[model samples]
Target: MATKPEFLLIGPGGVGCIAAFTINYNHTANVSIVVRRDYETVRKHGYHIDSVDYGKVDGWKPENVFASVEEASKSGIKFDYIAVSTKNLQDIVPVEELIAPVVSAHSVVVLVQNGFGIEKPLFAKFPQNIVLSGVSHIGSHNRNGHIHQMQSDHLVISAFENPNVDADSQVAAANRFIEMYSNNINKCVYFASAKWYRYRKLVYNACLNTTCALTGVDTGRLEAAGGLEAIAIPAMKEVIRVAKADGVELPDDVINVVCHADDGDYFEPSMRVDVKKGNPIELEAILGNLLDTARKLKVETPILDLLFKLLTVVQFRLKEANGYVGVPEKRPIPDTFFK
Candidate 1:
């Protein structure tokens, strides 16, 4: 009999918890999660998941839980897949560095995070391994070891295009993941063009996600303050234009689709939640990378440029206040300047 495939997921947050649950529940693989901060809580009591697709469950956990990737690496079992569901804050620490300790020669790295151009560094670091982009469309929130997954888990999995890896190998790796992840309870489909999906998601992420963080409000509040029309729509349009310049033609009604996708629900974007909690946002991965692509294609994105500039300051302040190393030493403004 063939041995069960070993799957290790990092960051047992909303997406990670769901991924671990579905894979383990379906008996598809032997699942493990690398947790930090919440390790003790989760290891002691397990995870409490209230999922829309899987129904409510209490004290649920993966087959194995490690304190960190380094700890997981020391377990003597090589992982076939390493799925990362953490925030893609590349500015603070590269994602490649975090997972490198546990990545095996045959391991396929699966990214279940949001951001444009997030796979470049990972591609550079793990040239031989397949990097699958799992674009998740799920409304979920997690606090401590408890998770509330409201929306259905519809993950679009695709292999990031890599020159170093052959197309057949990449597709096979992605299809294997789709086979392992998909079951009667959830949907995990293979997408041929992951870049198109990433661009589509940016219509909302680049606009509402950044603007809400800047205004320090939820989507409804931002809409009420006229920011939806004044800031978000224009930025979203700019994203469409940039996507076009990058050769991905989005539908004409995409802006409207993104605007009303949530149906006026009161929700905070992940970036806004990060700002509120004093956590570093994925500014570089989300906005900076897209803007870089736009610049290369000579696409004009005035609104996004403005948002990026403003958020750069926000990110700087958060890093400084949080005492992140490499932040410049503080210096008071000169009193003589006022004179």
Candidate 2:
């Protein structure tokens, strides 16, 4: 009998919870979720996954849960795959330190966070061969300590064949990882050839997240106003220009599928929720990366530049007014929108 591959998911937030539940439900991987000390509530209450596509799931618990990476390491448990789905602003230094001792030399780390340039910093510490990048169009939120997954479009993973890893081995590994979650969720996971998935998702996120946060409107209102195409088309073009300079060959359909999709208001991006809660928005990950790439490629992105500056100012002001701490309560809808 073949042994089940062991997986460790760092962080138990929305994305992390989805990843853990998906992996556990499929039973293809032995998954463990590493959370903070406060996650004892999860130990008692278990997890409730309320998904729009898959329906409701209750009493779902991980194979194991640990308060800290150090504790998991002390247990002498080695993981074959490590997936991280934490927020963008989190400091991963401690995670890297604690997990390093428990990761086998052949173990692969899949990062499902936002942004484009995250791999560079991670590769600096870990072997480039063992690092992989992924992007997802999954929308989710936490309500009253339960995870509500609103949408699952598709997950794209970038596969690379390192000198230490053969092409067939890497392909097999990627396939196994994809199949592990194929049945647990409604979305499809595609393993793409190049690393363009990150850039493609970056373009989609930059426009959707920034616009929704700035307007303080839901996606439905944004679409109703016919402003999606106006903002998204130009932003995608600028991203394409910058990506090409970086030697990435993005497909023409990336923009068409991402920007022109007809998903309903249920598709609220994470940045929108962050702004609604008055938390620090992921400006650095979504827009900062775009502007940084443009600067490097000498591409002009005046629209993106303007949007980034505006969002930064709004985030700063909101933080200052809200005492710069704690999640903000949902704000009341404006009278202007009620008309």
Candidate 3:
């Protein structure tokens, strides 16, 4: 009997939860998940996902479930592919830090996460390792431990095109993920320019995620309240401008794609859910970093500037309220942060 290809996914958030389930549901690999604190419940009750297109799934279990990276590393298991799908809240614990324990020279590391400039740090750390970038369009969240898949499209992933990237390992990891994720419930595709795709995803993420989170509203609320035209579209245009400055020729029509893709008008993005739950949001990776790049490139982003300011205050208050020491930002919430 032959052994199945090993896959390790860290961070059981929206994309992580679905990716883990999809791998198991598709029989893709001997999938092992590294969830932060939901082991006992998930192991006993399994993961319950209420997928809109796929219907309800009760307690779908993976091949193996581990709590931390050290556990998997200590076991002397070598994974063919290792993916990090956690929030890009590296200030809490970098995506690299968690996966470093289990990563080997031959392992393919997929940063299935949000934000721009995220994959650079890992690529610098392990040049020999095959590094891939991934972005998800799935509208879902694991509220109270069960995943709620509200909406979705194909997950976009791509491998390193640089000459230095290990050809064999990198190609195999990218194709393998595509093969596994092309199931009835969902689809995953590969593109030549992942960096370009990252910037495109950022249009929705930076605009909608931040706007929705700060306003404490979903897409529907933004539309209902007429904030979409007032705030969301402007913020998205700024992202497009910044992307062009970075040499990525993104189309202006993408702004319309985001505006129309506001499925059901009530879909809550991951960042919005994080803010509502009082969990620390990815302020730096998602918003500030992009703003920083725009500044460096001398790109004018007045709209993004204001969004960054408001979202930072939201982050500060949410962290303080939750009693979690989050990544420091420019502003501090006043004593009367809540009226």
Whole-model Cα lDDT per candidate?
0.90, 0.72, 0.81
User: How should the candidates be ordered by lDDT, best one leading?
Assistant: 1, 3, 2
* Residue pairs in collision within model 3: 220-265
Across residues 36-133, which tens digit of lDDT does each residue of candidate 2 receive? 84477777777787977557988677888877777777777778888877766522233355457667676788777787666554555665446556
Give the TM-scores of the predictions, in the order they appear.
0.93, 0.78, 0.84
Task: After superposing candidate 2 on the true structure, give the runs of residues whose Cα lies further than 4 Å from its correct spot.
Answer: 51-56, 90-104, 150-154, 160-169, 184-188, 223-232, 249-257, 262-267, 313-339
Top candidate on lDDT is: 1
Models ranked on TM-score: 1, 3, 2
Q: Give per-residue lDDT, candidate 2, residue 69.
A: 74
Of the two candidates 1 and 2, the one with more favorable TM-score, higher being better, is: 1
TM-score comparison, 1 vs 3, better candidate? 1
lDDT of 3 by residue, 149-268 (tens): 888645887885545765665677788778866887677888877779888888988999988888889998898899999999888888988998999988858988888886665788
lDDT at residue 29 of model 2 (Cα atoms): 83
Please give the distance, in angstroms, between residue 37's alpha carbon in candidate 1 and its true position after superposition.
1.2
User: Which digits, one per residue and each the tens of the lDDT, describe model 1 over residues 1-339?
Assistant: 589999999977888889989899988899999989799999999988889998889999888999988899999879999999998989887899999998878999999999889999988888888899999987777898889999999999988888898999999999999999999978899999879989999999999999999999989898899999999998998999889988999998998888887785898998998999999999987899999999999999999999999999999889877887454369656678564
At residue 129, what lDDT does model 3 achieve?
78
